[model samples]
Target: MLTLTWRRGDGRCAFLAGMLALLCYISPASAEDGYDLWLRYAPVGSSKVEGYRSALGNVVAPDRTPTQRVVREELRRGLAGLLGSEPRFRASPAGDAALVLGTPASSPWLAPLRHELEGVGEEGYLLRWTRLDGRDALVIAAHRDIGVLYGVFHLLRLVQAGVSLDGLDVSEVPRIKLRLLNHWDNLDGYVERGYAGGSLWDWHTLPGWEDPRYTDYARANASLGINGTVLNNVNANALSFSPAYLRKAAALADVFRPYGVRVYLSARFSAPMELGGLATADPLDPDVRQWWREKAREIYALIPDFGGFLVKANSEGQPGPQDYGRTHADGANVLADALAPHGGVVMWRAFVYAHDVPEDRAKQAYNEFVGLDGAFRDNVVVQVKNGPIDFQPREPFHPLFGAMPRTPLMLEFQITKEYLGFATHLVYLGPLYEEVLRADTHARGAGSTVARVVDGSLESHALSGIAGVANIGDDRTWSGSHFDQANWYAFGRLAWNPYQSARDIAAEWVAMTFSPAQEVVRPVVDMMMASRETAVDYMTPLGLHHVIARGHHYGPGPWVDGGPRADWTSVYYHRADRDGIGFDRTASGSDAVSQYAADVAREFNDVERVPEPLLLWFHHVRWDRRLRSGRPLWDELVHRYTRGVRNVEAMQVTWRRLEGRVDAPRHRQVAAFLRIQRDEAQWWRDASVAYFQSINGLPLPAGEAPPPHPLAYYLSLQFPYAPGDGR
Candidate 1:
């Protein structure tokens, strides 16, 4: 049995007061170290302090797995900060009012609960306040050690979010079994679509020296129930497989292990030739299979729990089995076999397009993957990006979600703001994520949402996963701006529980990051909720997408054309002319809607039945075509673009009034960025309207603002050094 003790000024109450004092006024003191994140564990007032202390008298965590140790350390740290006293740890949970945490293997008391936890799976956990041996105690139980770690973090989150822990019967299992982050970071420190700064993984200084930031990074992800991270860009480098780089990755794996995060690598498909000196990297060849199996063994030897490969093969000129006239399933299954012995899975990316293929870019992924639906290995997951096209401001969910029900499909959402104005625009992607998640694929009838597909409930696949393209960088706030942090937060929360409402996630984030005070939280949550729609309205309202500047995608470029590939040009997507606009994906054209369920196909195929938000995405209407709004297509387009600009201007006003409510530095930074968003929103509206009006010869509607510059001026404007460009 273990004894428990609590000291005054040793818990969350003192820590909160300290942080409040530090951030009260803008000075050198206000510049935070940022290690706190949202888990400052700050001191509560005397009124609430005793309740927490009395409730949490001691800790008893017997599980000795690396992940369970992390949970124990976090509890100690959180209690120390919040209560201002370090709680005693007991060898067993025999004492009254003790906190018991473990898997069945570690805790005899939890052994009886194994049958109840059987449905929870390996990554699920249960937290309950129950009486044991005539004493009140808190029990955190799981089927596996990692789940116990997650349970601890969940409990801490509830406390930080100011929820009552009494009568807590929390049983949480991740909707998506594999929650991972895909970092588009290069070996040279440049991040693809990364706007914050250089990559967090400093390869030059790794293998021998480990940055404390790495641990904190793992901690943050663990807190959000994210369990894996792909440590390189999808445009992979072959040299990442070299022994030197492998050793560096092993070091990171060591740090991440305790936090329940397994490190994964984005593998270059030609690694057999580039790294192993094979003449031809054929999946069917004996030498190629042996090489991959050996490489997998080597990696597992270095880091026992390393997550497997994420491959972007035959996509955007990357090497793949297709290079040798082989199928995608053949390529993925080879690597999957290699890793299968070590209990690893392969995440094969479906973000494929080729200029040589004379088809709508949106239909390419579904065309390729659906053909080989059940051919993939059981351990292979097809990672499909949220939209068929690259992460645009607004796009219909990818058609592959329902098309390939036999294979496990993983949802790949971009947490990085590649199209929606990067980190500058105050767009909270929670609503955007929700929109896609809730979209009824109608594959398994009416209730078959995309979330169900991702969570493996709709198709009942053995393996399920979701990956977010991370936006984290070397910036002080982790993301470039402070509010952008909410996107990262929201991704983790959604990964944990796919059914959670975006509005609810936004409110929780606002209270944790800014203030728990209702007056301050309500306005901020409202702004965040409206932000994604505002960007869509101004930039690509009514399903218009990919109209940004060529290559950089910084501002509007509706006039862009004649790129190396027609698909790269903005004109290819919008297809505006004197007669009509929008890409024809109906029966008269690509017939991409046929890839979806029968009902969904009919709804999208018909011009009248298609939702107004996605009207232009599927159909091209004439300049004078009457919309549901009782306005012509041209006037409605202009109205939506103008309305988006006004919405951003309104956001600027709302942010300016929040000066004193938030810390001065962060407050000022958000205010300044909101100003940038407003200006850029206007630029988007002006450039798009001017270019479209030139093509259609339509007069501007009354009360709509004309372009600030001529069509030629907007077309000539160039952003050679824009951030997040692949180059």
Candidate 2:
């Protein structure tokens, strides 16, 4: 009904019309909902086109395997968009430029260079500019088809970033052995703590009807060099392992296999009794061992490269080997033995806590696993959360990073915005992750960081892995919000190389996701860099942890005291009184800092040496205690809270200036989300100020306004149906 017309010069219109008539294609730049994510291969600038256009006259791709086909198709799509014309396929390098894409086994040209690709391994590729038959060309060669696909994406990334393909010499191999994303997705499509929509796996229609989103999902993960994914929630159900569900998982696996991503399942440990007709699911029992072995066999039959079980045992209400008076190592070893014959690894979650409130809730996971360090099977990786307690806004490095040297340990981080204000708050988790990774664990020496421990550099272990609790769902944006996608991207980049800088990754994401223009990238990345600290300032400043509302964790609840388990309540952790505020993990209190290495323990215990950010986490300071800022403890807390709200306002101002510059849809969405963050940050500041003032009875300091409501008014507010609340 409507004819597309451009009021540009006639020459430009004629050229564009000719291109449209010839190719009949549309660039993904028109996609406003962010369905393309960072993979949007929009047209490059004239400079990039000039540098790369003559070098991409044809492609010499000889393979026709599924993965190879995928890489070829991606190149075609990307070249067409980025270069303004797709390259032609040539059997020989007859053109002046020919991009050769293949593994050694698939192409005669690459077979000679196979010796150079020796150390790159099965998933790493070698991308370089080389001469072919007296003509300059590019070569992307790897040991396997999947590796070629990764290189193809990397090539496209360079193009999107306006990087010249000339003189490109890159050889990339993932530093971590297994980069995994643990989806807290249930069978019924409900995602636990998922800020986005339902699970990507439509369980009802899966195994029969496959959604095109699945392919894009695989492509996105593969682009980041992520090799494995756990499909269901770690708080698992036995039904996920049933024959019907296994088929559905196999379907996802089939779609992912081409992209070199393996699908894993969170296994319910008590399935021997619940699914099988066994009275006792003891690890020592021959029948119990046989049941798991059969289950592993059945899973491998359907998914040949199936990743092993992700077990959450002896924690929460989930059943485990502990139910039969067995040790955690015993629980892990049984499954490890079953998966051993099939070349699988059992990822046993260490996010466990006793129902009984110990001297300190943070000390339980350390107490449980420290005794059995050398007892776990070689194939069993003890998956430890970054913090001892939970995925709080800030906490000291977990004591177990290098505590279990004899056992292969994997670092598990939550990418979901569970405590950082769900999906609404714009908290860039790169700095948060970097903080934990760079933390000196002091396990081996002063330089022993958590990153070294996870990458197996500290322990020199053969197996090393890292996991991120995924924030992905069925939303058109992939993540709930557009900027939230940056967190996902950051996690994958860090997972591939734990030592990579978060700010650098954020800048790259900004360039690819939004634009390469310096005007837009500079402020957006600055806002992202400050976002995590801003959230921490308002939500849990001065190292305060777990003060969020009970159950839902929706808003402020510093006064929460009574619950079934005292540890579950905010009052137990905060321990605010008329005299002082904050939990005292010092010698006079819980002495929880003593669990760390001697130097770390000393630093955490010393009030003066402890970092100001975590001061309240380790010490209970009096309201009148003067901080390094020369302000009283109460005044400093108020300053931080108000500063957080003001910082959000500053971010709003930064975003508002880019309205005409950024795409209308994305710019409008981010502006709206920034408003949410500003309001909620103020709520956090006011409600927290009100609650704490009731305790310390301190008046608002100079330049600070009193809260609009009393402590009771803030306390009376409830979010009964907040998104991502665990029902």
The positional error of residue 224 in candidate 1, measured at the CA in angstroms, is 0.9
Stretches of candidate 1 off by over 4 Å are 1-35, 63-65, 91-98, 109-112, 355-357
Point to the candidate with the largest lDDT: 2
lDDT of 1 by residue, 364-462 (tens): 998889999999999999999998888888888889997788999999999999998988999999999999999999987898889999999888887
Q: Residue by residue across 524-621, what tens digits does model 2's lDDT show?
A: 99999999999999999998999999888898888888868888898888888988888899888888887898889999999999999999899998
CA lDDT scores, all candidates in order: 0.87, 0.89
| TM-score, predicted candidate 2 vs. hidden true structure | 0.95
Model 1 Cα shift for residue 80 (angstroms): 3.3
Q: List TM-scores for all candidates, in order.
A: 0.94, 0.95
